[model samples]
Target: MIVTEIEEFSEIRVRARAYLCFLLQRYIPNYVPEPSLDNIINALKILKKELPQAEAFYILDKKGMQIIDAISNNSEYRRGKGINRSMRAYYYRAVREKRCILTDPYPSLLSHNLTVTASYPVYDDNKQLAFIICVDISLKDLLKLFHPSSIDSYFGHFTKISYSFFSLALLIVAILLLMKGVGSFFIMAFELRHINIKEIFESTILITLSLAIFDLVKTLFEEEVLGRHKKREASDIHKTMIRFLGSIVIALSIEALMLVFKFAIIDPQKIMFAVYLIGAVTLLLFGLSFYLKSISNIKEEE
Candidate 1:
């Protein structure tokens, strides 16, 4: 029962956030003479007539229905304050949490300026809640994130089977390239079998493609992923340095292994190994240069 109640509350919040985003992004900027509740409402009404699609936006004062930017388009729409005469759930949540909230149902006559509101509590330079950003939102736009349409629903199923098959084939090819690179690098260095450089390059390409796909997946569901403040850990910079060192070491290890094979096994030649030495040394120098530059900058700041 408690879980259900929490879910219901969450739904309401999204609607509010949506409304807030709508107003702030689209209508709020029009009122340039210092932002206020009355000006915000006036901007919405102007937007509704000009744009027609914007008639759904609104605002509320302490008195019930203190201001609705629009109420004429919909038949059941009624303007002015409703029964409640205090701070709304949306307003209270923003003031309390200091975070943007986008909940369900949206700013509708049913809930009376409740619904999806995207609101951020505005803070003055002195760090006080001067106002709350409220936006009326569309619920349909939000739901497309969590439960996307199935493949069948997306492409009409078997009719687009060939497209799916083609993608699968590409994925398989990428995997093969990665495997070949890994196998070549391992074998050439392991004294086991012939190492193929072509395979290694193919693997690298596939790995890059796979990472791109993963990034795209994150992009598709980004709305839900927002709200959390990105708190960079103390170790972020340290780990970044370590990863840079590791990449250099591993890449050299691969090239060195190949050089050992080319000169020791196939033929006695110093030329092939010389470039590898230069690159390894150059990478180390690059890291050192960056470290020195950072130190210099810090000292200047101090």
Candidate 2:
């Protein structure tokens, strides 16, 4: 009798997997728009009308990236939550194959339940790959699926406000650091003997131009080239290092000017101009080093 029961259990598992695969094949690849949140919303509406058993749904990019459903989806008691971010890879698989996918039962930690989902990929009219659409189904009120309750004391719950504040604080710190770099350059320039305004102006141009160019180039081209295969990129950290190292290089050039003032040429006063030249070259070198180091680190990270 025990052996018979074991055979039945295995049969159930096989049937479940088959049903999921069937659902994906039937309705996924043609389901949603590219991963824009607006189209995702519309897709959700249509899914509700056509498949009321569905609990929730989402569309992700080829990278298994969740395109936001606007401010509508958030982690809150009243707000909506979709799949946990960890499932991104599973969804991305369908996107890569440009086909539909269905997952066997998986646990949703947030919702504290086991559920099954099927993912569909949307393609452009050109038949180019677009995004993945995931659907959850249970024969009950769909909205309740996202509500993680009845055992809250067992695990810590968080407020979305805290997450927002953390992001804001990071942005504010970035602004302050940029302003500080500008101020430090002017203060150091003023300290030297008979500092000409022209030297300060030129140094300012070199520092600002190098940093901006470094930021843009690194983000657009370097990050893409180095992080193409990786799941995530290190763009932010790279920008930070570029600015820091470039500033240090510029500071050293300032010291070089002090050197030229003391002994490099017969005209001791001419050392000031020489200092500006050294500072510019130093910043340029530092920028290059920063760029190369960042690209190398991205390769390692990948």
Candidate 3:
């Protein structure tokens, strides 16, 4: 559940950060260089009404020491004064960057759930760091405020259902191919001496293709239905395509070899067909290699 919420948060992170920055910009600039505690709390109370989903709001000194107790609708999170937050990413990052920044989701000590903090640096009259304004929101609540089509939402549920059906159909097909390929070996009642080379090659091709399809199905189900986040690396992005193409290359190479052996033993005049198959396999290999190189270069540049 935490993983899903974190993944969901990532989708809406940009929008959430922009909205939080905008909110802070509207308020934090007014309270620079030492605002009274009551005044700050009153302002945060108004801000809380504007962003009712926010868990807590607080102020931190330039050095990341809490300036006052937190202002929150929930009483339990309202007493956190004097805590040093200098080591927190929200504090250090906002201070270092001198901008409104959102921290990544992490387990919250107060709420015991995934939480994200948006910190805004406040500059004084001399344009020196004065204080930091921070807002904490639970990951789920943050998504509710920002994500229009969250996985718990209607559209997301429909998408997952669609992917599940497609994955199930592909899984069935892979299972059928697997069964057929394995059954081929038993055609001679498990007698190794009676096994046909052609049958062995055909079974290998079927098994390879089935493995490829299964891999694709797994990738699709995990990414689309389960919302599993994969890295943007070249290998991760094009894994399914690489697997399918690799399987095709392997199967074709095997078929070409089988054809060459059969033609050499029977009709040497038709060896050109095997040559063509081998040439096609080689082209596929080249194409796959080129694809890998292009994506790797793109990743490196990024």
Candidate 4:
């Protein structure tokens, strides 16, 4: 469950960071004249009113020491005073970047759950660092705030269930095709003296198609249901499409070859039909090549 939440967070991390930075810059002044802890706390309280999803808010002095207790609706997160936060990523990152930044999700001591920290560096009127304002929000709460289609939501669960049923059905079909293809091969193997070339080609086609469908099922299950990331070299959807089409092209080519051989042996006049089928297969191969080239160009542009 935590892994899933992290995956979802990564998907929306850029948007979350931008929104948090915008909010912090809008509510908290970039530079104040001798700002006090009470003034920062009041600003955080107002910010919390605007964003009820935040778990905790705390102010850290320029040296990365908590100046006062945290302000949070939950009591557990309200006792963070006198803590040394200089070693934390949020504290150091704010000092390094000199701007508002959002930290990656990590386990929170107060909530015992994965939480992200948004840190905003405050400066004094004389251009010296004054303090940093930090807010903590659970990954689940942040997802709910920004992404309505998160896996924990109703629509997301429904989509996962639908994909599961479709994948199961496709998997069963692949298994049946594999079984039939294997049986055909075994039967052909036993009767080697009276071998049928057409039967061999048919079995090969069945196996090829079955393997393509199985690949499709695996990709769909992993990407849609498990939220796994695909390799950057190619998109999963495009790769699946290419594999399925390539299988069909191979099966058609085999059929055309079988027809040419059969017609040349039995009825030479009917070989022209095999010629037409070969032409169609050639056209399909060309189309698939074009599709690949187009996607490659798009990736390069990106």
lDDT of 4 by residue, 1-302 (tens): 66777877888899999999898888787777886767678888999898889999998999999988889988877898999999999999999999888999998988988899999999988879999999999998898877788776777788889999999999999999999999999998899999999899889988988998998899889877885642223676788889989988998998999999999999999999999999999999999999999999999999
RMSD of 3: 5.4
Candidate 2 local Cα displacement, residue 266, angstroms: 99
* Candidates by lDDT, descending order: 4, 3, 2, 1
Q: Please give, for residues 247-277, the per-residue lDDT of candidate 3 as tens digits.
A: 8899889999999999999999999999999
Q: What's the CA error at residue 187 for candidate 4, in Å?
A: 4.2
The 10-residue segment with the lowest total lDDT in model 1: 221-230
Q: Which 10-residue window of candidate 3 scores lowest in summed lDDT?
A: 28-37
Tens digit per residue, CA lDDT, model 1, 1-302: 22322343454444534544554656554223345766655765665565333224445442323344334355454444443423566667665676655544545554444234455444445565454545443333333222132221332234236544555555566566556656656666776466566456445544544444333333322211221112334344444454555445555555555566566666767756746775776778688678767766876887
Candidates' C-alpha lDDT: 0.48, 0.51, 0.85, 0.88
By lDDT, who's the top model here? Answer: 4
Candidate 1 has an lDDT of 0.48
Task: Score every model by TM-score.
Answer: 0.39, 0.33, 0.65, 0.78
Report per-prediction Cα RMSD to one decimal: 11.7, 18.6, 5.4, 3.9
RMSD of 4: 3.9
For model 3, the stretches where C-alpha displacement exceeds 4 angstroms are 1-15, 28-39, 60-69, 73-75, 81-101, 104-106, 121-132, 143-165, 190-202, 221-229, 236-240, 250-286, 289-302
Ranking of candidates on TM-score, top first: 4, 3, 1, 2
